[model samples]
Structure formats: structure tokens, C-alpha cells
Target: MFNLRTRDQIRRVETGKSTSNTTNGNGSTSQFGFSSMDGERQPLLGHQATTTLHAEPGFWRHLLFSAKSSPGTNSPNPFVRWPAQVWNVTKITLFSSWINLLLVFVPLGIVAGELKWGAPWVFTLNFFAIIPLAAVLSFATEEIAGRLGETLGGLVNATFGNAVELIVSIVALRAGEIEVVQSSMIGSILSNLLLVLGMCFFLGGIYNMRGQDGHGHEQSFSTATAQTTCSLMTLASASMILPAALYGVLSQAEEDNKQASILVLSRGTSIILLFLYCLYLYFALRTHQKLFEPEVSQVSDSDTGEEEHEPLLGPWAAALVLVVTTLVISVCADHMVDSIDALVATGKISKTFIGLILIPIVGNAAEHVTACVVAIKDKMDLAMGVAIGSSIQIALLVTPALVMLGWAIGQPMTLHFETFETVAFALSVLVVTYTVQDGKSNYLEGAMLLGLYIIIALAFWVSPTGALGKV
Candidate 1:
């Protein structure tokens, strides 16, 4: 009799027709529908209607059970739901790319470090480990940024996209590897400006040409935005040149306190650059935001059917993943830094080559791939932002931050790069300036950038470590 009564009540609630009324202990009459034990009204079980629930869930419940479960499944144990949601998010994040197969290296890296493995083993394992970790970091950062809307999202992306470089640099700086810190900083800038941007132009040109009914096609981005970014790069180049010039002039004069003078100058300049970065952010995000807004281009008929994927994780889950990934990256970076001396002592590679070429490649690999993929889709503005904007952050933000960090830590990290590196950086910026000056890109321009990068890499590979000392 009780079971039959419950069935009739559920049917009435499902139909959204509560015919019965109940008298509460306080003499208040209430409609007999779905209600919690606390007398709060619940939504009809089968009524296909939109309703807003004002209940606030607990923090742990919100975090763990944010993702909806699959349809038609019976309610499992409460303990199983959180883990299942986590597993779903993890699977989506890690298995999205074949590169994540390298994640096996993360644990291998830790094991190698703990087992007292040789420097080669540890370095190799940790180096590869950072690659997938970088990819995951990029993914999680985008997921979180997506929820923040465009203006704040761009800021979040700029800060966290370079988190790996920042982490590795901090580790090296703390270890007194000033050269490693400086080289990695410039390397990241070069890789983004030349290698990543070059690939974007090249692939974008090729893809557009194939998609369109033309032989000599060109991909174009916003000229004003490109000019603004290039001007900043020019300023960064000037910053590099001025310090090296000061060092040179002082050394030529036989000044007794040259290093001390340069140290003070570098610290002051870093603070100024950081200020300039803040201004740039304000200009881009607040005052003149429309200038940086992405320009829409006509999509080709072949591309119109493609769908964008929604973020796999909620903001909280993404933030959690980001924190976890960063911690893992720090562990891997520490292991890698510990092995650098041994790796260099083998005579097979120099510290300069490792810092300038190899380390930046690891740090910027995911970003490089992302820029090229977007460029191929003809989203030149976004591609340019990823490529050139990243370089700007490294130059105007990360480099300055490292100098400040070094000051606090008693290391002499400075803007004074080697003469050759400064020259390469200047020339690379010049080439990019010219390439983007007209707001048009073609395969030839891209080929030129890649050619120049290859030349620079070869020169570094042959140059001995410490041979090109700071000016």
C-alpha cells in the first residue's frame, strides 16, 4: 500500500500537477510536489521546462562533481562519481594528442633522478618529459582562459603560455646558471619570432593557396597591430643593444667597476621594461582593445563545416590541472638543470647550443604547433598574436622579471647577451619587421625566416661555449 502511494505521488510530480496539499507543523499549507527534507521545492522530475535553482553547493562537491555524467546510467556509489569525472577530464586532456604519449617520460624522469642515473639518462628523460607537460599546460591554460572572456583571457594566456620557460629559468637562476637563464630567454624570443612565425606564414600560405582558386595567394593580417608589435620588438632590440654597448664602452675605458656599473644599469632597465609591459597590457586590454581585436576573414567553402571543440574541463578543474602540471614541470626542470653541467662536459654539445636551441624548443614546442595550426586555418590575427605576442612577452615581461629575480637571489643576470646573439636577435627582428611591414605574408617570406633561423642555429652549434662572452 505504501509503495503504491509513492508511485502515484511520483507520477503526479512528473506531470507537474500536485493536486494534494499538506499542512506543516506551523500550520502553513504547501503543495505536495517534489520537495527536499528541508521543505525546499525541487524541479518536476519529467517536466521539460527551464528552471533556475538557487541552491549553493559545497566547495568540494562543486569541484569534484562539476562534470555531468553520461546519460541513462543508474546512479553509482557517491564515491565513484568524482573519480569518474576526473578520469573523463584527464582522458580528454592527455589523450587529445599523440605527443602526450611522451607523458610516460614524466615518471621515468622522476625515477631516473631518484635512481642516481647518469646525467645523460636524467637529462634525456626530463627533457622529453617537459614537452608533453608543456602541451598540457597550454591546454589547461586555454581551458581556463576560455571561461574568462576575451579581454582577461588574453592576459591569462600571455602569462601562463610561457610558464614553462619561466619555471625552467627560475630553477637555473637559483642554481647560479646566469648564462643558461639569459640564453634561454633570448632563445624563446627567437623561436617564437622566427621559427614559429615562419611556420605559420609558410603553412598558412600553402593552405590558403590550395583552398582558393589562385596560384599566387597571400595571407594578410592587421597592419596597425603588426606595426605596434614590431615597434615593441624594435624597442626590445634597443634595450639589448644599449646594455651591451655600455659594457663595451666601459671595458674599452678600462673602468675598474664595469661589472658593478652594468649590474646596476640592468636592474634599473628591467624595472622600466616591466613598467612598459604593464602599459602595453593596459593599452591592449583596456584603452585600445578594439585595435587588438581579432579580425574576421571569409572562410572558404571547404572550411565552413569544421566545428570548434568546447573546453573539456571546467574552470576549476582546469586550474587544478594547471597547478598540478606546473608542479610536475618544476620537478622535471630541476632534474634537467642538475644534469646540464654533466651534459656539457661530454664535449658533444656546448652550453650555448643547449640553452639557445634545445631548451627553447622544449619550452615553445606546443606554442609553435598551436600557432601553425591556427595559421593554416587562415586565422592570421590569432596566429600572429601567438607568434609575435609571445615574443613580446618574453622580451618585455619574462626577461625583465628574470633580471629582477636574479637581483633578489644575488645572481648577475643581465640584459647583456653575447654580441653575436644580440646581432642575431636584432637582425631577426628586422627581418620580421620587414615581413610584416606591408601586412602581407607569402611562402617566400616564411622561407626566408626559416632560412635565417637555420643559419643562426648552425652558427651556434659550431661556436664553443663561453667563446662569445658577454660584451
Candidate 2:
């Protein structure tokens, strides 16, 4: 009789009929139906069983299906939906701040170039255009870094965060705008060391000052890390200073061979700096990582709950955005480079001023915004990494790479900065070294750095084009 009842239940399940509930000996209803036979739960069957048996579609199939489906109210046509979906994904990937709104300038800048608009228009539009693209680039880099873990992530951030400067410098280098390339390099370094770092300290200090108590608070970071970074900056300054000094001495005594000698020295120095940068990466990321670690604060259980470590975009999507944004920036940079001469002639602005002040400000704008935001969040260690790390990259990596590139392309790109610019670089490093020596920051130090930057900018504004020998 039990075997016959089991066969009947199987037949019912096969026929997709609901299993009837049975009452147990204890007078309780067994909703599982078969529970009455052994007083134990049994596997669900019939219509419900199909859900468990159903297989999920593969990635390609799902993607194809999504593409075929309507993209909701955005569009009804599949082709239109696909594009809308891509745009939506791009926005999500690149849109981190209000700064992204300036992305509109990208198309405008490209159009201006095609329409043969005046240099000022092309330069102005592309200049603004690169700002938002840079911010997007920064966002994409961070997304990728976040997914890469801490050490590899730091390297990724270090490399790609300065993509704007690298791309623009390369464009200028290729165009034989050697002064623009060199000045922009030093400008990036100075801006990061001074403007960005100062803003971080200033905004961070103010944010921390609003403590729960009446007294103001001071923010602190790893002193070991700060000192190490400052030491590297000093090394970079020495690199710049030696080349300028060599050029100066040789110009007086060996004018015929001076240019060739400076070029050789720059190439050799660039090779060394690049090698040092590599070793520094190994040291920071592998062996001496502890020194660069942020100070961990004690938190209660509630506060210490797990935070989301997920990246905003998938790995491939982030990389795609990075490549696309970089390409766009390259285009805009090329347009800007082509217009630099005309801009200089009409605006009567010194190339030194543009390279040292305007171009750097644009290239480093994303870093500036990022550092300040993190600093305000009291992440001084991260803020410092973004600010000082960028400068170090420009000095030790981008500048040298440009020299090698010039060597390859037969351009006379050297490390010989003008004497005044060299002095500014040296002084800027000196002041920053002093500021971060103690690993503690306050608003006052930030103000002083900003003041120094202003003084340097003013001096350059009145100065004529020097090393490039352009009027």
C-alpha cells in the first residue's frame, strides 16, 4: 500500500498537480503532503520544482537578450537602446562629481578644431574640455585601482592619475613645442607640490578643526612616508638644478658644445631617474609598505562594520573608459598645443606663465580636486599620496620619459629649465620639505604654501620666455 501511494504521488508530480496535504497522527496538518508517511519533510515537486531545475542563461546569451530588449523609456528601438545603455554606463563610470558636467566641452572643442575657429577659441574650449576629461580619467583610474588591491592599486593610481600631463606633454613634445613640454613638466610638479598639497592641508585642517570639543584639531599622517616622499622631491629638484647649472656654466665657457652637452646630460639623468623611480615603487609597494600605511583609528563595533570594497565599474568597463578618455584628452591636447603659439602672440602671455601656471593648473585639476576631497574626509595619508605622489611622477617619471621620447624623435627635449624656473622649483621643494617634515598639517602651513605659489606665479607672469628663446 505504501509503494502504491508513493507511485501515485510521483504520477501527480509528473502531471503537475498539487500534492494534497495529509493529517499526521498528532492531528496536525502536513503541508508537505508526504510528511504524514514518515513524519519528515520531503523534496518539493510539481510546478515549484521547475524553478530549481531551470538553468541560468550564459553571459553572452544574457547580453544578447538585454540588447534585444527595450531599454525602457530612454528608447524603444534596439539600436537606439544599445547606444543609450552605453551612454548610461559611461556616465556612471565617469561621473563622480559636478566637474563632469564640463564634458560637454569635449565635443565643442573637437568641433571648434574642425571648423577652423581661431586659436583662442580652440585653445580655450579644449583647455576647459580637458579638465572634465581629466576628472573622468581620474575617476576611471580610481575605479580600476580600487579593484586591484592596495599595492598594485597604488601603482595604477600613480601612473594613470597623471595621464593628462603625460598625454599633453607628449603631444607638445611631438609638435616640437619643447618649452611647452619642459615648462608643463615642472609646472605639474610645482602645482602638485604646492597648490594641490596646500589645498589638501588647508581643507583637511579646517574640516578637522570643527571638532566635537571647542578646541581645534590637527591632522596627522605617517611621518616616515612624508619624509621619504620629501626626500624624493629633493632628489628631483637636484636633477633639475644640476642640468640648469650645467647649461649656465657651459653657456658662458663652451657655447658651441653647450646644447649637445646638456642634451646628453639630460638623457643620462633621465635614465637614472627612471631606474630610481622603479626601485622606489618596489620599496614602497613590496618591502617598505608599512611605512606608507595610513594610521588606523580605533572604532566601535558599529563603526567598524564592513564597508563596501566593490568598484563602481567592472574591470573591463573601467579599462575601456580609461582608454577612451585618454584618447579624447590626447586629441584635445593636440588642439591646445597647435594653438599655443597663436595664443601667446594674441594674449601677450609668456609661455613660461602658460606652462608654469595655466597648463599645470588644468592638467593637475583632477588631482587637486581629489586630494582636497580626501583631505577633507580626514584621509591625510591618501591626500598626501595623491598630491606628492603626482609631483614625484611628473619629476621622476614623466619628465624623464619625455627626454627619452625626444631622443627617439630627434627633438631637443632636455632637463635644462630657465634659471628663474629652477630657483622656483628648488624653493618650492624646500618649502614643501619643511612643511611636511613633521607629518602634521594645519591651515597656517597651507596658507603659506598657497602664498608662495602666488608669488611664483606673479614673478613668472612678468617674466619673458627664456629657455625656449621664443619672443
**355-462 per-residue lDDT for model 1 (tens digits):** 888899998887687677767767677678878988999999999999999888888888888899999999999999999999889878888889999999999999
Predictions in order: lDDT: 0.75, 0.72
Judge candidate 1 against the unseen true structure and give its global Cα lDDT, from 0 to 1.
Answer: 0.75
Tens-place lDDT per residue, model 2, 1-471, is 001111122212222333244232233433322223232322111000111111343423322332111122123455654464464455464445578888889999999988879988998999999998887887677667765666677678668767888899889888888888878888888898888888888888887876678787888888998888889999999998897777766646566588888889999999999999988888887798677665665112134342232343545667878898998898899898888898888756878888888899888776677668767767677678778877888888889999999999999998888777788899999999999998889998998998998898988887765533410
Using TM-score, give the best candidate's number. Answer: 1
The 10-residue segment of model 1 with minimum total lDDT is 43-52
Q: What local lDDT does model 2 show for residue 98?
A: 71
**Which ranges of candidate 2 are over 4 A from the true structure?**
1-85, 210-213, 251-253, 298-306, 466-471
Rate residue 86 of model 1 by lDDT.
57
